[model samples]
Target chain A: MDVRSQVSMVFHLDKCIGCHTCSIACKNIWTDRKGAEYMWWNNVETKPGTGYPTKWEDQNIYQGGWERNGDSVSLKGAGKLRGLKNIFHNPYMPVLDDYYEPWTYKYQDLFTAPEGNDQPTARPVSLVTGETMDVKAGPNWDDDLGGSPDYARQDVNMQKLTPAEQEVMFQLERMTLHYLPRICNHCLNPACVASCPSGALYKRGEDGVVLINQERCRAWRMCVTACPYKKSYYNWHTGKSEKCVLCYPRLESGQAPACFHSCVGRIRYLGVMLYDADKIEAVASVPEDQIVQAQMDIYLDPFDPKVIEEAKKNGIADSTIEAAQKSPVYKFVKLWKLALPLHPEFRTLPNLFYVPALLPSVGTVNNGIYNSNTNGLWGGIDTTRLPMKYLASLFSAGNTETVAEVLKRLMTVRWHRRNVTVGDVDEKTVNAALEDTKMDTATADAIFRLTTLATFDERFVIPPAHREESIEMLENTGDVKGNTGFGFKERPARGL
Target chain B: MFNATLNQFLFVIFPYAALAVFLVGSIYRYKNKGFSVSSISSQFLEGRKLFWGSQPFHWGLLILFFGHLIAFLFPRAVLAWNGEPVRLLILEIASFGFGLSAFIGLGLLILRRVTTPRITVVTSKMDVVVFLILLTQIVSGLCVAYFNRWGSSWFAAFLTPYLRSIFVFDPDITAISGVNSWWLKIHVVSAFSIIAIIPFTRFMHFLVYPVDYLWRSYQQVIWNWDRRTIRNSTKHSEGEKSTNN
Candidate 1:
């Protein structure tokens, strides 16, 4: 067992309110520069609508991740020979138009232009060309109107549902939307790393942060093609690929990432997860249906004495182990089994997990009585506003049972709490709800507390990064003492 | 020097001068700006034309290069290989096929540069000049090959001796003058001029070939050229992983 600690994250989709505060926060901190204005490192995508970079999940067009051959898998778009052949021009790469023609208003014109008879307006100009242009599109053009046919009709997930079901989803009253704030998965099996011909992209051994070394990037642009999430962006100015660093500088200092800190709903959870490194390939190579179980099996329990001993032997700090034990991500993902990795079928074995949102309103209160007139306090998963098949495709590789199980556990918690707070839910129905979900009172109560009322510390159990030793090993510590800066001193430029 | 004829300058002075500049300039470039050595490609700007232009051009050029190399280095072997009349016919036909492709590809590329607005905007004067020079060289070489059929069989007897004489510092201008073909002279001089101009242009990228890329692992971490520091940190990271297990 080659035990290694990966700094994993879990976003509880239930609590997400679809505010793009996280997106703005991350953009302001990381991507508000030349060639990067269009990149939103943390964009909150409204599900049922085609996302930023428009229909990124349609791997048929983008060819982003691994595709199953007979027994093994290869990158859908690239291999060694194919990569070299297409190095001159990537056939599958998305251009600026695919994301959006990022624009800024000609504010100078507003200030400097001579006053006219009509209201003088600052016309939108393309950031790339600095030319006055019609405002065509944006990063989140289909923001709140996820159910509208103009945007949601193109959603890749809609293909999984039957025609009738799809038609039902578009119904005015039945139309429901949920936020899916995306960042780089920082996958254990990163196709971007494998696709990079220059080998500029690598997952750091210490923290599992995938970074593109700007100095070494040859601008092959394969990373942009290989990232299934489309998180990697090509900086035309720098002639290099850039991606989300997961705010590693803040992570090392025991602070939440900018997006996480600024999140209005506090949906993001950060923590350490100890997994057996030896199993990564085997787990990732399995059939799509078995991928979730395989991923779960890879993550060794923090409380396991054998795993704990091996972790210490592998040079993991004691504090990090303690933090792993306290990680809400670990509880949500491995223990409570509430969260699932997005598109596990993509087979990247993504590090970021999502607790599938229970979007269907359980019941309405009529005359001060909570009326869930079903078999018990919780209604059937099939009747939820967000269809079971949709969540299943997103989270469980079309395993409706898995999505149902998580939703049942969540519903049990809700019903359990409702019984306590309000007398409308009878004692028998409450017990039945718990029994039907097969969840104990203690687990349900814990889930309720963590989901609803978790403090910042409880939500993000940051492990001590201990980056000094790594840096000291790489350079003369005494010689480096005077300098205090992040990343390369020189700005990366084209042609080298 | 003003009194020197064009042939006198092209044959003797130009060869020596070009060779000297080529060697010195290549060395200077390798030392001062080693990292900037890359074939900066505008393939991303207008790729469809490049697909047609670049593929045939690269293939024809590569095959021609090896053909020239083998013929030059092992003239006796080439003579023996061409003893069979049928083999000579095959060799002549293949050379014509490759040379035609090269000609066509080069013509299309030049046309593309002028027509494609995106590529034209990035095209420097040096790039245009180099393109025209290559076109002239190919045309001259093709004209000689077409006019003097079975020249490859006889080239060993004439040009090889002259080239060998030059390599030995013997300066056999008379032996090259023995061929007395203006087209051949134009081809050789233009080819030499291309060599001289290579270091100053984007052709420097061809020097740092990506041969190592074929067999390497996907993930690579560059350590800013400090081997010892990288090794130590790698060991430390391994230790971190090992103890954590």
Candidate 2:
């Protein structure tokens, strides 16, 4: 089956509270350097608003990810000859202004300026040019301004909606939004890796973490456009391209990634998954409607004896296989089918899955008491405040049925949990919820525990990274014995 | 006498100087500091005008380069193919078309650099020098081609011999000195100058590929597994038995 183990992640959107704690934690660790001030390796995007770098979903501008050139998927932005042709100027690259120009308040001015009359204030200056600038935008500029005409109305996701529906969404009363916390998907069919003209980015064999080799990076900036998520960034000061490393050093040391570790909502789950490596291209190249199914089909059951045998033969460690068995990501994504990969239409076969948040449209208040038309706790999946069509565009490659199914599964879990905590819900609806899942309360309880109250050990089942063998291959075991996994012995600075 | 010295310097010394610098400098930069060796593409800063300028320039340059190579290296073959008047006229027409496109593209690029604020801000001193040299080369080349019709038919007797003499260390200054046109000489000299400064300029992007990317497979799979790991892992119990013992 050409099975290979990849450390994958799941984020329960229902549990996320839209806090940017994970983003700040990741920033402090990875992207606080000179040219990296603009980079947010972990960003929480508010739905119905253009994301970081603004309108990243607008493929018409950025031109990232893969497109079907018949049966095979070709890089949407760059390929062999096209890379050479555009070597002088990448036509599709996002400018610094496309991402807001990184700026720092001249805090020194606040301290150094002699007291004149009023309170001393800092002026915003561009990080790259050091020129005083009028502050306009930032990484979290549209954080919670969901119904704002400036930000939310510009969301590329609005393209999927009819004009009437779009008009309705922009209304203050009908407006709905949720937080989408994102990191590098570390995809199986990584367009960044494929589009790198210099061949700097590669997926690590042991953990499937995508990493860029600093020595090999020539800063072609093709990876910036080729990545559909706009996750890759060019270090203007260093003359190189950089992106999230997935905190591999933390991973090697058996800790969760910085973003995952600092998640305040505790929505993040980390675990290992085994997928058939051979089917990656075929899965990514499938018709738009069939992409989600194709992606799901490639993830082999870790408990399957034959799949486990194939994984072992492919050099997967025994401990990694064990972790795959315990992976909450596996259960949420594969078994319960509550979690879905973000924008499967991008055809990256993204490893990160999201359990869609419930926001039903029909909730109304009568005499200070909230009521739903359905006798059940929540409305039908089709009646969600965030339209099924929008969720379909985001997660299910425009397939509303799959989005509805995922929503039903999530609502079933919520209903099951409510039945346990309070006895307000009727037995008929409880039985229906159970029947919809085609299971008993035990499965729902397991889903509930993992989603809500799972401990660190339960949420994150990190495999032994097995990077030691690679290190040993490059250097003698004795020479590298006590060395930390952090690459670059010296701190990276500007210029050669 | 001026023409003779110029011919010796341009045809003999200049060719060697440019070739040596182009080869050694490119390799040295590739070995020591590979990342700086890039096109330094200013597209991110400004791109709309670049599409019009870069596309035509690159396409015209590639066609013109191959045409020159075929004429210089195998003049006799090129001449034999163009023996008929119709064939010769067609070839000249095509060459003129490419030359005209390249000139227009270069003009647009120069205009872009001067007019576009973003491009001008990023334009280095070397970028200016390279652009001027290219302009001179293309202008001189176009003049020579227009003034001297059917030069490709007689390339074997003129420039090829001169080039061969330089390669053979014979330094036949008289070969090009007898050509009677300084415009052709200017074109050749400026072309050599462009080659000499290429490694130092953004033009090095065309040559510097430290990694052998041409042959590597599209999908990269980093295999960290070595002998010990391979031995420890097996489809069946065979390797497990060895590890257990």
Candidate 3:
């Protein structure tokens, strides 16, 4: 089976509150450097709005990821011939203007003003040039204004919706928004790794963490265009490309990643998934509509005796296998089938899965008693604030049934929970809802527990990384014992 | 004796000294300061100007470099081909065209580097030095091509033998000493000077050009330990579909 262990993740979009605490935690840990001021390794993007880098989802403009070519896939922007052809000056590369010129207030001016004016204020200075500039944009410029014409109406996914449906989405009372906290998906077939001319970016075989060897990165900037998610960023000061490392240093020590640990709404789930490496190509090569199912099928069940034998033969530790068995990600993604990978059409076979968020139920209280006033506790998927086609575009490859099926399961869980806890939902309707979605009470309850009330340990099932086993093979660890600092051996500078 | 001594210093001693520095310094930098080896592009800060400057400069330089290499490597073939008047004219004109392109591209690049405020922030002292030396070399080359005329024939007849003699440890200077044009002499001297400073500047990036990328597998998976054993053990096994059954 060519079994391999990947540290997979599931971000429950339902629970996310768009607080950006995860972004701050990630920033404080990794990207608070001179060159990385604009990089947000963990960015909370509001769906139905143009994301960071402005309309990044429009592949025609950004040209990130792969396109299916008959039996195989080719990079949309970069490959051997095309990459070398445009190596000198990449036309697709997004400049600092695309990501918004990072700036900080000239607070010194606030104190050192001539004291002639009635009020003193700090002027914004560009981090790139140290020149005074007008503030035009920011990373989260359209934070909660998902209904605004400038950001939300311009969403690339909104192209799939009918004009009337798209117009209805902008109505003040009917408008809905959800937070999509994004990090590197750490895809099985990563375009960033393939696009790197210097062979600097590689997916570590041990844990499947994609990383850029800064020493070997020649500033080709191909990865910055090849990455479908626009996660890889070029550092102007360092003259290198950087991306999310999935907090591997913390992960190696058996601690959750900083973002996962500090997530305020507890929307993040981390666990090991044992996947069949042989299937990665076939899965990624499939048509866009079949990609999600093909990708999920590649993740082998950890408890299967034959799969466990193959995993052991491939040198996966028993504890990691056990962690995979108990993985909350596996249950939400594979078992309950409630979560879906974001943009499966990208054909990178991304490892991160997202449970589609259920929009707030549309209902009215007739007189006094608070009633949901629908067939069940919640209305049908069609009646939700965000259209099914829009969610389909975001998660599936415009597969509305997949989105509808997941939402139905989530709705059944809510109904099942109401019947159990509150006793308001009648047994007949709840059972029928459960039967209609093909989910039993136990499965619904389990999905509910993992979705809503999972403990820290339950949510983050970190396996022992066994880094020493791998590190010893590469170099003499004893020689590096005295070196504690993390800065480069030779600082990244422009010239000699 | 003084003229002969000067010719020996410039043609033999100076060339060898530069070659020594190029070889030793490059190896040392590669082994120790691997992290600093990169093109160190500033395109992110400013790209539009770079597109105009970088593409033409690179293409022109690459074509000229390979053209010189062919002439030096196959002097007999170049000389034979140059025997025909029409052929000789075409070769000279093509070389001059490429040289002019390189000159114009470099001019734009220098202007962008000097005038653009953002680019100035990243331009180091060494970068300016490299740029100035490169400018001198290109300008001297264009001057030789324009004024000297039929450099293809003369270069094949004289400089090829001189370069070959130096590589073979013969240290012949008469082949280049008889040359009258100062522009050609300056071109030879400045070319050696560039080789000397290559290791100390961003030019070291050329040494590690990713030529293997053309043939190597696109997907790069790095394993700290041996993965062949892992692959072999599973080679005979069926995929997950069979396992499910």
Candidate 4:
């Protein structure tokens, strides 16, 4: 089977409040440097609004990720022949303008201003040029539906909706939105790794964490276009491309990543998944409509005796396999089938799965008064206010049935929880909801606990990284004992 | 004696010293300061100007570089080809055209480097030094090409022998000293100087050419297993066991 272990994640969209704590935590640790002023490795994007890099989902403009061509897939924008042709100038690359010019207030002006009639102001200055500039945009310029007409109305996912359906989504008082916090998907078929001319970017075979070797990066900036999610960023100062490292140092020490640990919503779940390496090409090459299911099918059941035997035969550690069995990601993604990979049509085989958010219930406005309680708190999964087709486009590659099924399972849990806690929901409806979704009470309860009240240990199941084995293959650890420190010998800098 | 000594210093001593520095310096940089090897592209700061400047400059330089290499490697063959009057004229004109484009492209690049405020922030002392040296080299080269008609023939006949003699450990500057052209002399000295400073500047990117990308598989799934076993999968388990041991 050629079994391999990949650390996977599931982010529950229902509980996210979009506080941006995860983004800040990641920034403070990894990207809060001179060249990385604009990068947000962990960003909370408000759906129905254009994301950080502005309409990143619009592949027609960025041309990121892979396109299925016959039985095999090819990079949509960059590969061998095309990459060499555009080596000097990549026309598809997103400029600094696309991601907004990162700027800072000239705080010194407030402190060192001369006496004047008017109060001294901290004028905005471009971080790139250090010149006074009019602040046009930022990473989170469209937070909380700010500039809805310009940003939210331009959302790429809204294309699947009819004109009338689109209008209802933008109605002043009736609009619905949700927070979509994101990090690197750490895909099995990463186009960034494929596009790098210098062979700098690579997916770590042990854990599937993609990393860029700083020494080898030639500032090609192809990865910036190859990543469909716009996660890879070019550092202007270091003259290299940078992206999320997935907090491997923390994971190696058996702690959750900085963003996962600092997540205010507690919606993030981390775990390991075992997959058949032989099936990745076939799985990724499947038709767009079948991509989500194909991806899920590739993930081998960790508890299966045959799969476990193959995993061990492939040199996978027993502990890692045990972690895979207990992985909350496996439960949410495979066992319960409630979580779906975001935009499977990208053909990246992303490891991060998302539990699609339930839209607000449909409400009727009577003589300028809104009555939301008439149809109860939760609406039918098929007739959500945000439209199932929009969610389908974002999550299941236009498969409304998958989104409907996931939402139905989530609703069953809510109904089951309400019947037990509040008792307002009728027994007949809750039982029928469970039966229709083919979900039992036990599975619903487990999903609810993992989704809502999962402890830190329960949420994150980090397997011990057997660094000694990997290290031995590269260099003698005993020879370098006490000789190396855990920091960069020389800071990454540009110029001769 | 003084003229001979100076010629020996410039042609014999200086070339060897520069070659030594190029080898040792580049190896040291690659091993110790490994993270510093990069093109350090300023395109992100100002791309539009870079496109106009970099493309023509690189294309012209690559063509000219290979042309020189061919002449050096096969001087007799080049001389035989140049025996035809039409072929000789075509070769010279084509070379001059490429040299002119390179000169113009370099001038545009210098202008962009000096004028752009964002680019100025990243400019270092070595960058200025390289730019000035390149400008001198290009200007001198262009002057030699324009002033000395059929210069390619003389280069292959006279200079190629001198270059070959040096490589064979016999320092011969007889042809070079006898020619008595300041433009060609300056061009040779500047070329040697560039070779010396390559490792100390961003020019080191030339050595680590990403030519492997052309042949290697596009999808890089780096398995954490014995690389030998990946190449020869029949001994996969045996190789794995040995590596573990």
Going through the candidates in the order shown, the clash numbers are 13, 0, 0, 0
Per-residue alpha-carbon lDDT of candidate 4 for residues A285-402, written as tens digits (9 for 90 to 100): 9998899989999999999999988888777777889999999999999999989998899999999999999877677789998876545333666557778899999999999988
Residue A337, model 4, lDDT: 94
The full ranking of all candidates by TM-score, starting with the best, is 3, 4, 2, 1
Clash count for candidate 1 is 13
How much DockQ does model 3 earn?
0.44
TM-score of chain A of 1: 0.93
Which candidate gets the maximum DockQ versus the true structure?
Answer: 3
Worst 10 residues of 2 chain B by lDDT: B236-245
i-RMSD values for every candidate model:
5.6, 4.8, 5.0, 4.3
Question: Any runs in candidate 3 off by more than 4 Å, and if so which?
Answer: A361-372, A376-378, A467-496, B227-245
Q: Whose lDDT is greatest here? A: 3
Candidate 2 CAPRI level: acceptable
Error of 2 at A224 (Å): 3.2
The full ranking of all candidates by lDDT, starting with the best, is 3, 4, 2, 1
Off by over 4 Å in 1: A112-115, A361-380, A478-496, B1-50, B57-209, B218-245
What would the DockQ be for model 1? 0.23
Q: Candidate 4: where is the Cα deviation over 4 Å?
A: A373-379, A466-475, A478-496, B221-245
TM-score of each: 0.83, 0.87, 0.93, 0.93
Fnat of each prediction, in sequence:
0.13, 0.39, 0.72, 0.52
Q: For model 3 chain B, give the 10-residue run with minimal summed lDDT.
A: B236-245
Ten residues in sequence with the least summed lDDT for candidate 1 chain B: B236-245
Q: Of the native A-B interface contacts, what share survives in model 2?
A: 0.39
Q: After superposition, how far is residue A443 of candidate 2 from its true place, in Å?
A: 2.2
